[model samples]
Target: MSDNSSKLHQRAVYLRNLLIAHVTGRSVNEADYHKLRHYFMGHKDTSRIIPSVLEKHPDLSDLWQMMKYNYASHEDRKAFIDSEFSPFLAKLSPDSSQPSQALLSQNQFIDEPTLLKHWLKANEMLEMNPPVASEQMKVLLEKLCHQILRELKVVPDPRQHDLTPLVSLTERSLLLSPGKQHYLVVKALVAGCSEAMSAIDNLTAEGISVITDQAAIPKIDKPTSLVLINLYGSLASMLLSGWRVRQMLVEGNSQR
Candidate 1:
């Protein structure tokens, strides 16, 4: 088998074994199984053409090797996935009080930067050398860019003390070597923030009629305002990771 084919086979086997363990309730934890399952569900429609990739980018052997050994044992892998996803899932209400039909029916629109990252990557790969690599690169880049935007939101709104830790976190994540786990954590945060922010912005822009009560409005001072702007630039840096990942994926894909 070609190297790409073999790697794909190994991943497929790993997934299958995980599923079996999950069903047996003996090997994999329930939470980990669900988390890994959700990641796959999120991109179920995408095709993973491993053989074609190997044919295009033969040089990926070393990089793939680096990634292969990094994953922990299957059990540890599951725990990591669960932890990465737990925050996002926790936001959903368990109580049965039904949300308004209007709120439920609104077509969820991902935020501007998130959507832009996806569309831009897709556009760039339209005439690329390898179709599969081009698409994967696009998705990875989109995720990275959206993640940066999410970090922006994490920085204190300037109503608090220094966000040095938050800033450090953003920089640390960005500087890490590319790997599947890193991508997952960053993407989940990005997707969550993108969804939340879009909802907030939409509500705020819904004309003055909908927001008749201005009595309790809070104001931001100059330092806070400047901090917010700087936060935006910091987000821009993270967003650029998508482009970098895109270039790498595309280059690798083309070689196949």
Candidate 2:
């Protein structure tokens, strides 16, 4: 399996085990709790699972409230799980399985720098022998654009036709003078920011229309902002790499 797939599977298993322990009155270690928090806060789809789990085990209502409000102490969480969840725990068979050791040991953290690092590696590979066809370059640019958008959590509007503008801008930046190339790259990055901001705005409006908790607004906005910043950083790195490659080619041609 691919490394990403494997890591995702491991995380899934770990989360499943942690949930089982929580509902079954088993003592959850600090590592498992931390992993749970990481998954809860980091992944949108995974965060939805908490509500589903709560629905199934309403006895965990207090625990869920504490967790949601960010007021649950370690001792309080442990005590509540052991005492309040007893009726639900009694129905479960004894769990013999442990959390995945591989997952525990693996450092699967992803941030802007990590994304940029991978982008640079791929960019270097392309630069080693520039693709022969302009069409091939366009295809690569489209892939990079989509990857950045996906990472930024920017869902494209169905009304919009394609990413041709962004891709063309990126491609144009590759052949420009160094100073001009930087400006073009910045423009391309700004286009990405515009799309990302639009997505964030739509989501914020939707969220606010439904959930009106003023305190929860910052919790939502902070993460969204961080995600946008990270996306911009990665997109900048990708565009700058293209410019850097162009510079190398220009210098090589001049020398020849």
Candidate 3:
């Protein structure tokens, strides 16, 4: 099978085991997963590359198809074998001899262990002290959003999920006690603005209509109050809010 296919297969196995655990109220025995491995290797028609390993296995074909298609590159395939699949295989055969010295050193950093460790340490610090103010939350939220946008641009495949940990982290930092309520508010605000912007774009394409609302009345009578109530002034203020959101998304891109 192709590299992408292999990765997909491993992901399928992980998901299957997860579902089984959820349904049965028990985790799969990592050591006794011969059935799954056998199932993956049994069928034909797929597993083109590693067919010799399980050519005659009747069940391997279906298992192989689930994972073989998503591999977009050789690196992805190698990553799957080294990071996800090999660990499970290790669990299944614990008595196997040690890996070669080079492989052993490389395995130690699989799953980008350096990044994971840094994330864990930062998490521990946050847990201990806690974010106490909105300002702190704002800085963190911007950083998180920046990271999300960066990843979105780099990872072209639809199968790769973004790091949602940033969302929760920013949410937590922003509102300590009333986090849940604020989270809903933030979601609604973003959704509403996005919808409104789309509507504005559509409307502008047709033609701009200047409505003669009371707020649009001339300021000659009461210049100061009229300035505050003028339709154009109000529209400009509203436009600024939308501009800010655009700036936020844009600023994040430049920073990276």
- lDDT (0 to 1) per candidate: 0.34, 0.38, 0.31
Error of 1 at 89 (Å): 24
* Per-model TM-score on C-alpha atoms: 0.22, 0.23, 0.22
* Model 3 C-alpha RMSD to native: 23.7
Q: Which regions of candidate 3 deviate over 4 angstroms?
A: 1-33, 47-167, 170-246, 249-256
- Could you tell me which 10 consecutive residues in candidate 1 have the lowest summed lDDT? 208-217
> Which 10-residue window of candidate 3 scores lowest in summed lDDT?
210-219
Question: What stretches of model 1 exceed 4 Å from their correct place?
Answer: 1-167, 178-216, 222-227, 242-254
List CA RMSD, all candidates.
21.0, 17.8, 23.7
164-245, model 3: which lDDT tens digit per residue? 3333332233222323424444343333333433443353354311112111111112232222123222222232333334
Order of candidate numbers by lDDT, starting with the best: 2, 1, 3
C-alpha lDDT (0 to 100) for residue 1 of candidate 2: 33
Q: Lowest-scoring 10 consecutive residues by lDDT in candidate 2?
A: 209-218
